[model samples]
Target: MQEIKATMAGSVWKILFKEGEQVGANEDVVILESMKMEIPIATEKAGTVKEIKVAEGDFVNEGDVIVVVA
Candidate 1:
């Protein structure tokens, strides 16, 4: 399993994949809003999305796990 973590503190703006969906390496899984900028968080591995750890509008800190892929 691989954990996709938030790269910076922000509010989750969108979730790009659903649980059990197949994802490619470096695919954007979530979009986060901070300081009026949108930052896309991507997975480093190609795998099925096993979990979504945050919802839209949820606040997250840097290093927080946002999704799990396996």
Candidate 2:
């Protein structure tokens, strides 16, 4: 299992994958808007996305869980 964390405080801009979607290592899974920029969050390991903890335009803190892969 793996936890995909946010690198900065931001709003979730987009979710590129859905629950149960397969993801590759280093694949971009989420996009966040912070500091007036779109930052992509990449997966560290290949796995199915088990859960998404935030919605579009939802605010998140640095190091917050954005997705769970397993």
Top-TM-score structure, candidate number: 1
Give lDDT tens digits, candidate 2, residues 49-68: 99999999999999999999
lDDT of 1 by residue, 1-70 (tens): 9999999999999999999999999999999999999999998989999999999999999999999999
Tell me the whole-model lDDT of each prediction, alpha carbons only.
0.96, 0.97
Q: What is the Cα root-mean-square deviation between model 2 and the actual structure? A: 0.5
TM-score of each: 0.98, 0.97
User: By TM-score, how accurate is candidate 1?
Assistant: 0.98
On a 0 to 100 scale, what is the lDDT of residue 47 in model 2? 98
lDDT, residue 29, model 1:
95
Residue 69, candidate 1: C-alpha displacement in angstroms: 0.3
Q: Which regions of candidate 1 fall more than 4 Å away from where they truly are?
A: none
Which whole-number lDDT from 0 to 100 does residue 17 have in model 2?
99
Residue 44 deviation, candidate 1, in Å? 0.5
